[model samples]
Target: RGLFPSFFREAQRREVLLEDLLYVSSAFERIAEATEEMLAEMEDSLRKPVDPEEFRHFWLALAEDLEREL
Candidate 1:
């Protein structure tokens, strides 16, 4: 990935171990899994929803994830 070189550079500077790098990779995988699940559950109907609570919960989860990214 475009970011891989930069990540490796920083990892080298920090002397991060191969084991720690594996853990970091796992973190990215978890994020991917969560994102896929959220989309599966909500994105197909992201435009709008009939139920008030479903609308609220979906937007809240999306907003939380956005904030976490920032």
Candidate 2:
């Protein structure tokens, strides 16, 4: 599924060009790539044992991040 088919549909109805959509989509593409890289790094770190306190801190920080907007 696409991220925002309805949004693109509306934009098209409003006469937005395909080039404009492609231009804006680059930002989403970059964000997705960066997120994948960060998650990969986190996964590599977690492959080994971690300190209990540090793990707790990481979870708390992630929760705080999720509580806010991107």
- Pairs that collide in candidate 1 are none
Error of 1 at 54 (Å): 11
Residue by residue across 12-63, what tens digits does model 1's lDDT show? Answer: 8677677789899999999999999998879677665579887799999999
TM-score of each: 0.41, 0.43
In TM-score terms, candidate 1 sits at 0.41
Question: In the order shown, what is each candidate's alpha-carbon RMSD?
Answer: 16.0, 15.1
lDDT winner among the candidates? 1
Q: Which stretches in model 2 have alpha-carbon errors above 4 Å? A: 1-16, 51-70
1-70 per-residue lDDT for model 2 (tens digits)? 5859988888877675666788789988999999999999999987978799998999999999998856
| Candidate 1 residue runs with Cα over 4 Å from true position | 1-16, 44-70
lDDT of 2: 0.87
Show the lowest summed lDDT stretch of 10 residues, model 2.
Answer: 12-21
Q: lDDT of each structure? A: 0.88, 0.87
